[model samples]
Target chain A: MILTDLRGRYQFGFGRFMERDYDDIPGTYPLDSRTYRKGYHVNMFLMSLNDAECRDKFAEDEQAYLDTFRMTEDQKSAVLDRRFLDLLKLGANVYYAFKLISFDRQPPQVMYGQMAEPRLTFDEFQQMMIDGGRPIDGNRSVEEWKDG
Target chain B: MAKLIAGMGTSHVPGLGAAMDNGKTQEPYWKQLFEGLEPLRAWHRANTPDVNIIVYNDHATEFSLDSYSTFTVGVGENFEPADEGWGPRQVPSMSGYPDLAWHIVESAMAEEFDLAVHASMDLDHGFTVPLSIAYGQPKEWPAAVVPVCVNVIQHPLPTALRCYKLGQAIGRAVASFPEQINVGIWGTGGLSHQLGGERVGVVNPEFDQKFLDNLSRDPLANTRISHTEFMREAGCEGVEMIMWNVMRGALEDDVDEVFRLYHIPVSATAYGAIILENK
Candidate 1:
């Protein structure tokens, strides 16, 4: 009987981040990818200090740690503006992003680019990725198309 | 006297078969992918007249991680399609040859294999993928399949030599059957690719090629490769290649290599297919 091994051809990942223009400010703290997308220019600020010790000190007085970060009225308003703290409290999407990054090790990016679009369903995205820039046969049902 | 016709070794990578069902083969990039199987298809039509007793792993679909058996055989009339997140594939469910299947089960037991016999089960992609490739989705497939599902997913899985000996038992059982039938044994899964955890995309093409070559010439020698070494050289999942030794042990020392196909696609796994006929 015929046997064919088909592995390592398609990659799957999350959509690209939306790019936007941000005004450059001197001495501004670098932002992590997660916080940067949320319009927070906050830096770790405590990079110069021992992170564990600072965290322990902060644990003693939480409000003092919050007041330590110097912020302008506009920055404070923006931070509170979108319920950003509440969202941060909801926890980071490390699992989701990790799954996306896993795609990096798969096949080339072009094979799965169409799947990166937000509009497609997971199955449709999988099908589109597998199609790999080819037209799907109109006649075959989803089940028919899948049978070996 | 009924004799062993051929022995085949293959990778029953779930994603490879899943890709076919997912319409991956129709893509231009994958056009060359399915073409590799043409020779095997031709060989099957010309020479493989009856059923192939497929040796494969269940990937924890039929047998959960809670408890795992080393080896299981299907002696049931029909097998259900497993729900592997995407539900079952659209095809006629396989009907077992209970008489033939039970005979082998009994024979293997008598021979000290301690095989678990299943009266009812839904075979996962591991069993079905090779079946689909060997025998297309015919209204009724020519061969009456007797599935021998191995447990490779769980730790303390069957040893390479153990699977090889099981194959020898299978050969004896097939030969003892009252009805004369042209039977072939198939061993599926692995030629090096890891599909889990941080080391997911690992591939060892060199080891895979060597394993296939050694399998054809000196299967016993190939079976000597340890599970630890197999995992180290072929990746953790590569340990599944042990199943091939089972098919190899069933055949003569030197078999004619009919066809061999190897491909590595987007799934971060290595795919291999080989058919060897008795010289």
Candidate 2:
């Protein structure tokens, strides 16, 4: 009786604001909803690493393996070249990209190093993190932090 | 009838897991943030609930880009931690409340909220790290968990309003359960820190504080926030704040801010934690 008498109520402050579009940041590939839709094939193909059989097949014949999935020529090239940024631009999420990195037996810092301007070696990237993460002030956005 | 007793939110920064796993709580870098979790420790010490409906996003550890479900409830018997390249954390398996999970799914679906069902899936730090923070490295989780996985990693996350409404539906579902049980809702992730791009360590304490104030004072107003604003003002990945709405929406309109924590530089993230009890 007490439960029924006391009903739950949620306050939703109904209002309006100019909903903004997510398309400003330069040199950054946002894994936003649209990107997910556009890069669906490429991302799913990478996701297949969860299965040992697929991983074995990819190890044997990279192109023949990629052919099984209908990815774009650009995505095919990005994966072929082990281009982390290229894959990111083509719609691969960092976490899913980890599978690809692990397949290459490389640490994730390799991908991090790949993203930075004037790309550093895997060792340089690891040392930088140890020294202190890439300072946020100068690397915020291409528009805000022009020097980066 | 089942009753909703508490709602809380926190970040699932994998580094926090590393800290706890490696026992670096007293280090200068981690000392303050580790101290922030004392309130949760105290709360659990006393008023521990029987079950926690953990609402967290999967970080590509399990559900990869292939089959990402917007909202999924784990109705399996137990959830074991994942290997995730590095070996699994030394923690006991988490017990799942299948009866409650299935009930919530049915109730949520009946209310017109499409929720996916999962019998088995490896949970990553997003789910496990918060467990470590709240329950410590206990032999077992202090309470049974009904894992509710939300897809925040993929772009085009559910609108803040939709997350709030989904929480409301989950609250109703929990309340309508025939079995009587004390349930706590936990939403984990995000307090304004971006991991990717040039903006690697953007810790917006100002934005983080306002988020805490509003989440504590008036979450209703929070639902009106747009995803673009969260990404821009908060950070590219800061939009993960939507998961908190699910936690807040599960509570009664009246709640008390029992405890809250906010710290920065938790490995490229501004970690945040909060506890809200039905007042």
lDDT of 1 by residue, A1-148 (tens): 1222222221112222322122121111112243433422222222211234554544465445536655334443422332222222222111112211222223223222222222333344345434431221221122432352
- Candidate 1, residues B1-279, lDDT tens digits: the string is 346789877776555566567777767656776778777877887876466788888753556423457888998988866654344666568878788788888988998889898888788778888877776556777677788888775555678999889888888888888877788889998877544322233466677888888888777878788766665556556778988988888787778887899876435457799999987
lDDT of 2 by residue, A23-126 (tens): 55434556755567767888787777655677889999999999988899999989999898778878777667767876776756677677655576767655
Candidate 2: fraction of native contacts reproduced = 0.25
lDDT per residue for candidate 2 within B88-196, as digits (tens), equals 6677899999999999899899888899999888887889988998888887788999999988877657889999999999999888898888999999999786655
Evaluated at residue B25, the lDDT of candidate 2 is: 89
> Which candidate's DockQ is highest?
2
lDDT of 2 at B222: 81
Model 1, residue B20: what's the lDDT? 67
TM-score of each: 0.65, 0.82
